[model samples]
Target chain A: MRNRQKTEKDTPLGAEAAQRRHRAVLVILAAALILCLLLSFTLGRYPVPLRELLGILAAKLGLPVEPFWTRQMELAVWNIRLPRVLLSVLVGASLAAAGAGFQGVFQNPMASPDVLGASAGAGFGAALALLLDLSNSLVTLLAFGMSLLTVALVFLIGRYVKGDRLVGLVLSGIIIGSLCQSATSFIKLVADPTNKLPQITYWLMGSLSGASWRDVRLAVLPMLLGLALLLLSRWQINVLTMGDDEARSLGVNAPRVRARIILCSTLLTASAVSVSGMIGWVGLVIPHMMRRIAGSDYRYLMGASVLGGGIFLLAVDNLSRTVSESGIPIGILTAFIGAPFFIWLITGRVDHYDG
Target chain B: MTVEVEHLAFAYDEKPVLTDVSFTAREGQFLSILGPNGAGKSTLFRCILGLQTKYTGSVRIGGTDTKTLSPREMAGLVAYIPQSSRPTFNYSVFDIVLMGASRKLSPFRAPSREDNERCRWALEKVGISHLAQRCFHRLSGGEQQLVMIARALMQDAPVLMMDEPTANLDYGNQLLVMRQAKALTKEGYTVIQTTHAPEQSYLFSDRILALSGGRIIQDGPPAEVLTGETVETLYGISVRVVSLENDKMRVCMPINII
Candidate 1:
């Protein structure tokens, strides 16, 4: 409210300053993400020295490099560490971008990628695949397919319901999500007690531990496609947040644009979950943080969120590995960071952002 | 441009909300829609804006029926300003105004330099260029309403349709918004607005449209249609239409006011 009345510097210079701040934050976030990716390469259990990590990266860029570490170290950096780091980046960027888009279109700050039941549906898919003893690739494919299908169902139902489009989409998502969750639980109930149940439970908790070059390759295209579509619609997403009637009056085909956004976000989220398991908090928390930093314009919010989310997950994944001998799951660590921040967010600042 | 409505009617769930509604306004004219709740003023606005397609009637703008025109084409002809309220996001006032030019913007591009200048021009027209940096949701109700008017102006359309332009405003702000709307008419734009206050209609409008029971009961100049009997019948309250000596100014004062 204090910022509301102080149009004192309402000059063009002040507006320019605000634009400068947004650009600055975006630049800083992008730089910080690159730094974190390099830093994550050096922080694991058998830590590769920073010099060795740099030399390996420099070698990859086609520059000649004298080896600072042995063949095993090179293998660790290129084979094991790099793929997992890249996976974290893809999953993190995809979720945050989708989450920010979802929040905008739904006009709800609390909205996340799971608002349309993609996560629960994908979780059920993965659990069913595991219970049936399917191959890893088959499990991922099923999960991705199911997530898209779930959202499609919710979207179709929301379309038929005659009410506020945002509310109907969200309501149908919740209902379908609960149903999928129950189906997943039923699979748990009937699974073999020892090997299969633990795998399902651990998978549901989320990790990048099993990440490989294959997963990274498979996830990158869909994530990038979804991200690109979202970035293109950032300006339209701004109009969407104003509500449907206003959007139409401005000559936007509100339903078409809203569906496009929902579709892109769903595909992005489903691809991420198929590779990384049901990672929470990255989607919900990172968008909130980006909005607070850059305000709610989707133009800056989308790019800032991608970088911010990637940096956050890479850092969290590092902490997950270094904090314990066996390494905690990435999902648990995200909660450790996200829950307290959300409490801080909601205690005083929720209502104003709604306005 | 000319706006012509013929035999416009609408219903919801077998209940008629507007029937046989018709009106026409041309360049440099100001029209006010006066009615109580459920009188279908908003529905009529929606039909004209091409938002409500299920209705049966022709809303012709410049000899082209709205039903025949695309939504984009309709936007080029009429700009709509909804009743002002706090928005969900804290978009800068400039960006909010820029959105009004979406009809001219491509889906994959930012606002062009000319669009930005137009937005600034609109801000100046409403005398709020100083608050262009402020969050739209943070402004006062009157300021928000003015920004909405500026947004409508930025659309650069020939006709402006506003829903309750002075709603939820104090007296001074009401006059401020009403005066700006009136000024738009002198610039050769057709301005149509709805208001519950008959006095505001009498004060700001060159013509009045009085609606009751889902129909236009009276439509004419303010001096003819906004009489004490029509005002009383529309709002279900008896009021005296008092005229002042200065330029024949009128005020609708309730008879019960001692």
Candidate 2:
């Protein structure tokens, strides 16, 4: 059992130094996110120049700057691109943070924001709203309410199950999620093939198209509340990763902490999905990538996931708007890009997860 | 802190796991509970730690009833070291040990500079200061056990309860961990650990509580409680307890049965 002992010099940095390093990494991620935001402002179809974009932003902020940009340019920035871009960032950060939180709370590597069926329920809600020919705002409202209701149902069923609580919750999620998918399929079968069918399909594919300031306002409360709570609960979440019994020994009330985490994650997932229909892969992939960069401490991991996720989805959304005349759905791009990368990550380093 | 128990009876559903179990461990006392695989040693430790509270008994730590205490108060009175197991994520050893400071803080507070200093002190106490930054999963079984002991030290409680701390270690590492447990007692910490090896209790424990089938068979000093008859009663094995000539240490050897 005796390996050659290393001197202090041979060891890595101390705990404080390592924490400082992780903070630096988070700062770097934030900077990258700002860069993506800047680049996204200029990359759309209307082609707003960098200077004019800044001028419009300054005018919007009520600064003492001259309006060198045209009214059309102002409309493009304020009406179309700004809401879409801002919504992408909010949705991305929410999904990623929620994903990271769920993974940690469940202590399962494959756990994502949709583990409790929030996304599936939101998807079904949106599809039903479309079939009934509801307005856009109503669609979002129904989706949000439905998502919360789905998770609440999952909890009720989970409480009645026989085995481990986490396991019961997961199994209930699968069962409820499949039921929602089947309902969505039935709605698709009954809707108008040319109009409602296409709308439901595109919405389920997940997109930030037609994003408005209202969508942002509606999603902000729940998402911000969830994100802030999750961030504050980071230390408790770390204690929880040691397992229920160990957490109890450390004076942590594991059940209450777990309930708080689940509530926050559900809020985040529901808000994000209600805004942007059922976007997959960002929640699962971004946090996994952040683990490699930020090292698994939730203090850094949550922040890194938020920034990294915003940058990733914003970049992908930019590509979606610019890559074609009609723009690809954001979800399609995330899955296309995320699946192979996830496989590579799992295969590239076997030790990243416990076998 | 002195641990006191009275009529500690526990059962899972309809089956009884511990029956009428009671013992007192005083300050600076190294107590070992020796039992076989199916014995109620672990269940008894669980009751004392407050992890399993469905038992019909009273457990008082330092004169405070455990049922009257919150989990945080219970943790302040006693720290537990579970058998080493791999975590899902590969957190660093420093992070793992730092978690022990949770017992003293509010739910939302992270470890502070003072907590970090305490972690460093705990690591140094276990002689693994250089391994703080290393990944916990990469460490050897013995090193992991030391890391856990260091975590328990970080809890800074007067009482330490270990459930088979050296269950997965080799021979030398077993003695190494036992020596550390014994040393903790000298520092005025009440060390209570459960072990399957009679020799471990014979060597390091000030008091031995031999448990079998949900009951205590014997409770006394090592020399008085670790007789051959006690070993046979605990493990259902015929063993000879021999005292070394020079070191005056007692060791048990099982007899060959045809």
Docking class of 1: medium
- Model-by-model lDDT, in order? 0.87, 0.89
Stretches of candidate 1 above 4 Å error?
A1-10, A348-355, B256-258
Instruction: Report chain A TM-scores, every model.
Output: 0.95, 0.95
Provide the RMSD of all predictions against the true structure, rounded to 1 decimal.
2.1, 2.4
Query: Model 1 Cα displacement at A178 (Å)?
Result: 0.3
lDDT of 1 by residue, A1-355 (tens): 5554454343465555666779899999988998888788778787887888889889988998877788998888889999999999889999999999899888888899999999999999999999999999989999999999999999989988787777888999999999999999999999998999999999999999988998998899999999999999988898888887888878787888999999999999999999989889999999988878877878789999988889888889889988887889898888888899888876756432223
